[model samples]
Target: MLTKRIIPCLDIKNGRTVKGVNFVDLRDAGDPVVLAKQYAELGADELVFLDIAATLENRKTMHKMVLQVAEQVNIPFTVGGGISSVEDVDALLHCGADKVSINSSAVKRPDLINELSDKFGSQCIVVAIDAKQVEGEWLVHLAGGTIPTKINLFDWAIEVEQRGAGEILFTSMDHDGTKAGFANQALAKLSDIVNIPIIASGGAGTIQHFSDTFIEGKADAALAASVFHFGEIPIAELKKELKQQEIPVRI
Candidate 1:
């Protein structure tokens, strides 16, 4: 098995990093560049910069800020938010992002995943799915997860893989900011169906949550916000704990 990666997520809103519970009540966490540098120094395998409200608000991603953060960090970083087209992906890559994640746009234009994969290769296409469990259904959401679609999460994930997406960044909007634990059940199903890597996000409150995400959720990488954002879990120490638990990880 490949080593499980511990990734720190930076949710940028208006060029500032923020964290919230259940996707509401967002509060400032730190400056994006500073937080990215800190996570890089803490031994994070990778970092994800999400312009959380970019797509929802009908504007492009904050590129200038992304450029600043990318130049300051050493590890591979992924950028998302309002990335609706190949031009957006190209611009972000030129700005220093190692990978580009697509969320709402992919849901509305599933063909974009295939197009990007063909143009940039599957490795560069990360289909970031924001899902919520409502009435016993895992529904896909759009526009920073403020809108729900009729698409089922499992079905959509399969389509994304078939369309040539290299990976999936599955964030559980229901568990987001809950900090109780990850949505392991959703992850387990996704991991079972998709051969590509899955980055589990949301509800990561403690060290054990990371372990559970890998072991129980069967995720290849675990991404969290507040715990790492507020100094609740040191990235290096968390990776150390995962190693001790025999989860393949880079320390």
Candidate 2:
């Protein structure tokens, strides 16, 4: 079986790491480079650095910060936010991002997924869908979860896959920062619908949540922020516990 991955997400703003609940009321987490190194040393299988305000601010990802963070970690890392064109993708990848995640821009121009995948190869492209459950249907959100769209989450995931996205990083806006658990139901449904790897984000609070996301949610990877950011759960401890529970993870 393919080993499931544990990833730590660093939501970046102004060169610092920040995270918010339901994508609002942001609070400082720490310096991005510092956190990246810490997570890498803690056995994080991968790391995600999202320039949470890049799109809203109408600027590109902080490439200087990305290069600094990239220097500290050995694991594969992904960078997202304010990425709209192949030039943007090329810039980030040149700065050492193994993959570039596109969200708002991808929704606005679905062909961007195709363009990126074609240029960088599918393995270098990730489509991040920030979604919220409304009236029983998951709706896509953009610009750091502040804008809503008509695109349904499941449908979007399928489209992204067909367009050649190597992975889908699905974040439940409703469950983000809740720390209750992952949106496993939606994750499982996505896993069944898409052929590419599915990464579940949001609502990760406990070790059991990690196991559930992999086993029950049927996710190939689970990404979290605050819980891992605040030292509420150590990556080493979480992996050990997950292994005990029979979840295949790099130890």
Candidate 3:
């Protein structure tokens, strides 16, 4: 079995690492470069740097900040937000990102996924979906979870794979920063429907949550922010707990 990955997410705003609940009430966390280096040293499987407000602000992700953070980590780094075209992906790759994640832009122009995959290979493309459950349906959201789309989460996941996305990073807006647990039922549904690997994000609170995300959510990787950022959970201890639970993980 493939080892389940534990990824620490750094949500950047104004070039500073931040954390929030339900994607609001933001608070300062720390420096992105410092956090990146720390997570890499602590044995994170991968690092995700998301410029959370880039799309909503109508600007590109901070290249200088990405470069600074990239310099601090050797792990497979995925950078996202305001990434719209092939040139943007190329620029980020040149800036040292191992993978580029696309969300709102991909929703606006679905062909951007194909373009990115064609240029950088599917393995380098990560399609991130910010979804919220409304009226008993998981609906995809854009512009940093502010704009709702008609796209269904399951349908978009399959479509992204068909369009050649290497992976799907699904963030549950309903669960974001709740510390309750991941949306395992939704994740399981996605796993059953899509062939591509899925990265489960949002609502990771305890060590058991990580294990559950792997065992019940059927996620290839589990990504969290506040818990890791605030030291509520340490990566090494979390991995150890997951290993003890018989979940295959790098220790």
Candidate 4:
């Protein structure tokens, strides 16, 4: 069995790490470089640095900050936000991002997924889908979840996979920062439809929530923000507990 991964997400705005509930009312978490080093030292399987406002502000990811954070961590690092073209991915990769995640851009130009996958290889591409349940239908949202779209969540997941995306980072807009648990049903459905790994994000409150997403949701990895950022859950302890529960994880 493949080991389930525990990833810490650093949501960045104005070059600072921040967290919020349902993607609003942001608060400072810490410096992205500092947090990345801490998480890497704490045994995080991977680190995700998202320039959360890059797309909203109409700019590319901060390469200087990315290089700073990259310098401090030895683990696999993934960077996202305002990444649209081959040039963008190339730049981030040169900055030491092992994988580059594209969200709004992938939705706006579906071909971008294919192009990046072909140029950088599928293992280097992750397509992030931000969606929320509205009137019982899960619809995709764009630009940091500020704009709603008619795109159905599951349908888009399937398309991204077909377009050669290596993995899917699905963040439930309804569950983000709630700490109640992850949107496991949606995650499980995504796992069922796609062969690529699924990284579950949002609503990770407790250790049980992490286990639930992996076992019940059938996710390959679980990514959380506030829980990890606020010291609500330490990566080492979480992995120890998950190991006790017989979940495969690198300790």
What would the TM-scores of all predictions be? 0.90, 0.91, 0.91, 0.91
Candidate 1: regions farther than 4 A off: 19-29, 55-61
| Candidate 1 residue pairs in backbone clash | 21-177, 22-176
**Candidate 4 Cα misplacement greater than 4 A, ranges:** 20-29, 55-61
Tell me how far the alpha carbon of residue 16 in candidate 4 is from the true structure, in angstroms, after superposition: 2.4
After the best TM-score superposition of candidate 2, give how far the Cα of residue 237 lies from its true spot, in angstroms: 0.8
Q: Which candidate's lDDT is highest?
A: 4
Predicted candidate 1 versus true structure: per-residue lDDT over 139-181, tens digit per residue: 9998767998999999999999999999999999998989989
lDDT of 4 at 19: 61
Which 10-residue window in model 2 sums to the lowest lDDT?
20-29
Segments in model 3 whose C-alpha atoms lie over 4 Å from true places: 20-29, 55-61
What lDDT score is found at residue 29 in candidate 1?
Answer: 36
* Superior candidate under TM-score, 2 versus 3: 2
Ranking by lDDT: 4, 2, 3, 1
| Clash count, one per candidate | 2, 0, 0, 0
Error of 3 at 93 (Å): 0.4
Cα lDDT tens digits for candidate 4, 175-251: 98688899999999999999999999989999999999999999999998777766778788899999999999998
Candidate 2 lDDT over residue span 1-251, tens digit each: 68999998877887777663222122423667766776777799999988877853434338888787778778899988888999999988888889999998899999999999999999989999999988999999987788989899999999999999999999999888798899999999999988899999999999999999999899999998888777788889999999999889998
lDDT of 2: 0.86
